[model samples]
Target chain A: MEEVRNQQVILKDYVNGLPKESDMLLKTSSTILLKLPKGSNGVLVKNLYLSCDPYLCCLMSKSQVSHLESFTPGSPIAGLGVAKVVDSGHSNFKKGDLVWGWTGWEEYTIITAPDALFKIQHTDVPLSYYIGILGVHGMTAYYGFHEICAPKKGEYVFVSAASGAVGQLVGQFAKLTGCYVVGTAGTNKKVELLKNKFGFDEAFNYKDEQDIDEALKRYFPEGIDIYFENVGGKMLDAVLLNMKTNGRISVCGMISQYNLNEEEGVRNLSHIIMKRLHMKGFIVGDHFNLYPKYMEMVIPLIKEEKICYIEDIGEGLESAPAALLGLFSGKNVGKQVVVVAHE
Target chain B: MEEVRNQQVILKDYVNGLPKESDMLLKTSSTILLKLPKGSNGVLVKNLYLSCDPYLCCLMSKSQVSHLESFTPGSPIAGLGVAKVVDSGHSNFKKGDLVWGWTGWEEYTIITAPDALFKIQHTDVPLSYYIGILGVHGMTAYYGFHEICAPKKGEYVFVSAASGAVGQLVGQFAKLTGCYVVGTAGTNKKVELLKNKFGFDEAFNYKDEQDIDEALKRYFPEGIDIYFENVGGKMLDAVLLNMKTNGRISVCGMISQYNLNEEEGVRNLSHIIMKRLHMKGFIVGDHFNLYPKYMEMVIPLIKEEKICYIEDIGEGLESAPAALLGLFSGKNVGKQVVVVAHE
Candidate 1:
């Protein structure tokens, strides 16, 4: 049995308002045997990449949103990450096998539910890609845009928070579906990437706009047919008014409302009824059944270079806190992934 | 051709905020011909059972909700009503044919789109039902509940504004589907009627509750599986928190939002993501293709006395404005119908 020091990022306390870097602190675990105990169902793995996602804001709270448990204050925050199995008491997993799913924001973890992990079979692509285009974010955009939105060819599409992990994909997916796509981002730098890099038909810096409703009217003169709602509150209200009749809103997450004591009130919801819109919210956990089908479709596009996936890599486990906090302020350029170890 | 004085309820001016009775005034035309011209495609109808519905609030506003034309200030306000065809140039209809659909809030109207009318075939039941359980409200409730919610037996269902036209039918429809149902109305009197008359498992006066979220917890201890959202604003905000995973919200109308300059901001729409909820808003107009099928199912229920429908009827056209304004205040306990003529 081998013992080693495990570097981890622990939640200092339940977060209030926007999470500050001080609310999380780095800790190194005392040496422990890396080998799984006898008859254990857990897999001991070395975590490589950790994903910084907006939904993480929900679990950092003590309020206990129905389906999620709040993060334990002293424990390592668990999130979607890429890991290599060190030893396993789970029969389906073996030493040296690569897997991607929920893992600790640390160097190593004992995952009790190995069944929840998806095996990383395609080494042809970057291993870190598992937490980027091939992981939870990938599954979220695929299902939220393709399944929930059900976009049709030539339909007008709008993506809010357009340069983030999920919104970027949704915008691209809309284009792949032959839809006219426009996107909105908090900064003009991200707005530029949405149009020039992500292939969005039009992109705007929402912060620069005097009135979002007026901006939306200009962008979508005929009205938006599908709105991939990554931001909520006033953005949602204005978008509601701009949606075409029978438009769809695939609510991936409301990054804007996550930190507030009182989430902003979306006042234009009546426009939903007036426009006969379909707004559906989804969690990626519920739709893992489609992951295999998703990889089958998306992997080919990735290999052929037909899909343009962007990455914003944070250097190490120490960067985890700032990396996660950056998502709140639109500091990251694209998919934010924290690399704990290269191998 | 014979002519007669035709009385109308004209919009005094485009209404703002909650519509006041003064916003509409009675007017009489010098004369209206009792016969259609030989080449005209319109059907001359004598309005009988005129419906006063909440959606009319949208058309009354100067801000035109897409898909609806704002009511002309001096024109007779139009709504769904039961009428007798006095003369018809359209081949599908004839003189003395009883029909129900869009008609002016007046004693006489020439419906240019007679194709929109649903011909009244069954006269055994109350003719005014054409505006209640058999008309737009009925179609709204049926499609919104069965088609949109897509409920299964044993699902926990919640209806807001539960004593109104659409909510009442939805509550009854849930019972017919063998689901557990609860409803919220503005008054205890309406609440009792919901439980005793409409067979709801539980009913509460939302106005009486100090905290609607707490009230929802009491009613739906396990959480609501289907939400027939007839009221938006704070009620919708609270209901969002109490919905079950994969819950369905059939957004029939948002009566609370219709009158507000800035409609109440619903802060808890994130519950849509937490519960993976499906929230859809629809217009009854888009779904009339199912009208024939709806009539087949509902007429038998009426005859068998298996379904309960309550109507609040105003004796004459003079009462139309008050009847409509009552909706904003929850003044009507059931479907509100204004009768212009009985023969």
Candidate 2:
């Protein structure tokens, strides 16, 4: 068996509050073999591109997410990534077949349960898109907005974290659905990008606003029909007040509260009952059954220029920790992707 | 036109905190008319039993509820009451018809919007029952639990403010639906009433417990499948953390937060995304169209003795304000109703 050098990003311990670069360490694994054991039904993959998602921070915390296990100390952190099969004993995959799903932060991984990876069929688009617009982020925006909100033409939609990977797509989807879409971001530059690049009708820098409730009222004079909740805490409290009667709030991520040790209180939730609001939360992991259907729709949109995707690319596995931690502080402008090895 | 000595419960001004007896004044109308004018479509009714609902406190605040208008300070407080039509120019009701709907908190009221009244179709049950189990409270429990939650058999359910007008019934409905239900109340007596009388599988006195989250875990170790929310604030925050995956929270009322100048912050709402929870809020006013369906189901259950309704009765019109305000302090054991004039 031919062995190769493997470098891995290892979690030193469970993270508390906001993550720092020191929480992760780069380590070289001396005992990793290039081939799977005989009779092992695993696919050995060379990880090409690794996704830096905000949710990994949650997995790194002491709390357990419903569908995912907490990352163990001294182990390589696992997340979604684009990889090519180098060796396989699994029937569904073979050598050189491109696949993307849960993989390690190392240069190579043996995905013991090979079915977790999706075999990439549409490679005409960028292969890295499989970790983003064609993968988790795309499925999240598609299902969380359309399936949850059920928008009608001219309905008002307000997306928080509007310039992020998922929010950008949701805003574009809202525009395409003939809805009046507004977005909120952390900086004026991102706000401009939202209105100009993503086609949002109006966009605002949430940091510049003194009162988010008044800011929302100024934009949605008739009140918001759909709220794509991304940054929770005060933003959610403000959104609760500005939501129209019978409005829908699709809970995707609470980026604001995730890093906080003492999470901020959302005080105005009583408005939910007062306005008969529908607030539903979902995890993208529970919804991969629709990935094929999602690919069918988003692929054409990407080809026809009907949808736009932006990525903040990091160079190597060394840049992965900073890229992932940057999501908490709003450091990355788009989908954060790290190139571990270029094909 | 006939004149009667009408004593009305007048709200002195909009209450800032918990309502007291002095916030309302017993006023005798100087200029009163008991009959409708020529070509007027009003119905003059002699009010019987007045419903003391917790939602009236929301109207008393500066905040606005979607379906119902705020209570005016100088005017007589209005609410759902059982009444007998003494004079009618409306086509739906004639003289001597017993009706239940929105009426002034007085011995007599001119119901300008007569269609708000529902003519008593089933009087085999008590007339006061119309304001409790047969009217708004009944509808609130039925639709909020059944339609919104869509609970399955053997699911674990939890209800807060479990001995109140609506919550008591929700516990019974859960038991009937083949679900295990646990209820939380302020007093041990009410907790006993919930388990012994209402057939809740388990009940606890919230005041006796130090940590609500721990109490919920003790009662619902498997995690709650459905939560019928009545008392909001800290209880809601605790429930959010304890909710099972794909669970539902039906926001019926927030009695604990209503009287506070600043509502408590719900800090654990991010658990919604962690558990993929579905939370919906509703007002009973919008679902009156289902009155026939509700009455068909509830009236038979009442007649068959399959359902039990408990009421904390107040003596007169003078006792109306105290009874309604008592809801905030958990002074009432069950549905608080005032006997303005017995049939």
- RMSD after CA superposition, every candidate: 1.6, 1.3
Q: What is the TM-score of chain B in candidate 1?
A: 0.97
- lDDT tens digits by residue: candidate 2, B158-242: 9999998899999999998999999999998899999999999999999999999999999999999999999899999999989
In model 2, how large is the Cα lDDT of residue A333? Answer: 86
Q: Write the per-residue lDDT of candidate 1 for residues B176-246, one digit (tens) a residue.
A: 99999999998889999999999999999887899999999998899999999888999999999889889
Model 1 misplacement above 4 A: none
Error of 1 at B210 (Å): 1.1
The TM-score between candidate 2 and the true structure equals: 0.98
Of candidate 1 chain B, the 10-residue stretch with the lowest lDDT total is B62-71
The superposed Cα distance between candidate 1 and the true structure at residue A233, in angstroms, equals 1.1
What does candidate 1's lDDT look like per residue over A119-175, in tens digits? 999999988889878988888899999998888999999999999998889889889
As for candidate 1, its clashing pairs are none
Cα lDDT, model 2, residue B304: 91
For all candidates in order, the CA lDDT equals: 0.89, 0.90
